[model samples]
Target: MTDWITTPVEPRLLRGALDVERTAHGILPHRLPAWARKQFPDPYLAMVEAQPSGVRLALRTRATAIELDVLPTKTVYQGAPVPPDGVYDLVVDGKLTGRASVPGGNTHTIDMATWSAVTRPGPMGTARFAALPAGEKDVEIWLPQTEITELIALRTDAPVATAPRHGRRVWLHHGSSISHGSTAESPTATWPALAAARGGVELINLGFGGNALLDPFTARAMRDTPADLISLKVGINLANADLMRLRGFSPAVHGFLDTLREGHPTTPLLVVSPVLCPIQEDTPGPVAPDFDAPKLRFRALSDPSDRTSGRLTLTLIRDELSRIITQRSADDPNLHYLDGRSLYGEPDFAELPLPDQLHPDPAGHRRIGERFADWAFGDDGPFAVSGG
Candidate 1:
């Protein structure tokens, strides 16, 4: 580490976070603004937001080696194996060039039965990338999506400067864990990240695991952010949590769109429904976690004939989303819809089944990313470049 230039990430060199807080460790990034965070004191939202899904350090340097020291907090469920260390992806000159992970960090242990969690402090660790291609080039170190990281220090063999303005269009996407890189191999491999790369746009992912319940604060955050393309991947968390019924779902969606329009009046706003999850497609959930299975599995605890009789079927929800998008598109032409299954439908599932029966596995993430890039960023797609 000799002769390495060490300093915290400059705000201008950071992308995708709404705010940065200088702390004892270093810089802590927030995807949501302080005002929006105050509206929800729920621990679920707190933890979800703290994990930097789309946040990254973007800079230009001739440095052939880079190292970032961070304190990552990994969540470990009681009785389950300790979660793997979070991955840091290095992209050099727009291509994924290397990957590294910290060896040790804090652990947030969760008791599934009691739904309680306790965090044990651990040591700071380093993610080092060496022998980057020679020349002054753009480099991005994508933070781990599933870990809550407190950046401690940045050390590069040569001085780095903020990357100049990349004229690529910005895409702001909000969704559930799928969009958050759940089960993905690395940050850059996540569907949204992959699609953004293929689409040649900058990404600001607002996907929070199990927390994309159409919250007004989230909508407000999306509304306030500047973006050329915007998308809402709704319906998954709403049904997974059994949070609301069709009675409340439609209006909440409308209100959410209304808020987004307040800021991005005509931004290409794409609304996506839930992808194909056999367990949840026909059944509603407050899905119970089943540990005895070979792999972590889930069971839909409640039947459709239950209180949520006709309202929450994934199919029904998709239909409702389609109807809403169709009805709204009459006046708002930029409003578009994408069937979630188009991204991960049955045929594709037969090939790459979801490892957990809920979240897609790493391969599935790549498939979804490829399809999305073709469907959403390709010709005639919602976010397609005019001359591309």
Candidate 2:
């Protein structure tokens, strides 16, 4: 009997369904990236709350050798139309096989003629890709584009290997869009992904876009899930969403951590604050929506005067978080605190300005990923926080 081994992915075409929602910028209709549009045109749209909007992709094989590519959509500051030609390459069996050209990268401008498949709308999007030949084949997929949001890889068959058993258990993380991979070129390139890989740890990414609100339900969810190491990246969204005041934030943060500690009294927990955002570094008052068009969406927050004057800053967030951690540390030694600037900072911002006054670009993602890998796994790092 031949010992058939499962591969990470099979040799056939692939299918995907993306649940996403358009927020902050509501001008353009929601659509797949340029590369995806080429294969599947005419997707459906709908209204949903709390859940991400859905989109799908189908990969098929037209030739004996299969190849494909993608260029993910990126954040265009204040909806300033993304650039053209955000193309990506597709690979099969560790070899470059095909290519995709995402014209404009966003707004459904993909043209995939060399391959075959139909794009339709159902739940998410109904799309189909060809399957692989019979027998065992090893497959590894990579995304060449650097954009934000989620990319889930589903295979037609089970992987040949089981989850490797390292000395320690897996670490499941929950955080903001940053943890979801804001401007990462590929899934594996995200900072969290890179950190997990470097640590040789299994990871379940529960990162939702604009969804880290320190909610009781989310905290309970984390409390209920099984994990070894747990971390939460907070602050920026609360500030951006204009959700609450400092007084309200402190208790909410404590409640969030308290709930997690209930389930994991001894689990090493890391609390991370927001990275540096120049515009909000030293300014006060909120960004007023243009009353003329509530949905116009603009950068009312970035002001040369405010930056020069020194007003709103991440230091405020860091200080608040530190105060909380200092108090909690007296009772919880397993608790750890991390400043986001340790991963990316003002100096780095000079090189990569995040396009929008917020969110890291691809290069920024790379920098953060590398820095995190070094800090969290270094000789004296806190990779493992033991408890009595």
lDDT at residue 377 of model 2 (Cα atoms): 56
Question: What C-alpha lDDT, on a 0 to 100 scale, does residue 225 get in candidate 1?
Answer: 92
**Superposition error at 244 for model 2 (Å):** 0.5
lDDT of each residue in 46-84, candidate 1, tens digit only: 887889999999988999989899999898878776778
Stretches of candidate 1 above 4 Å error? 307-310
TM-score of 2: 0.62
Model 2, residue 93: C-alpha shift (Å): 12
The total number of steric clashes, by the backbone 3 Å criterion, in model 1 comes to 0
Cα TM-score per model: 0.97, 0.62
RMSD per model, one decimal = 1.5, 10.7
* lDDT computed for candidate 1: 0.88
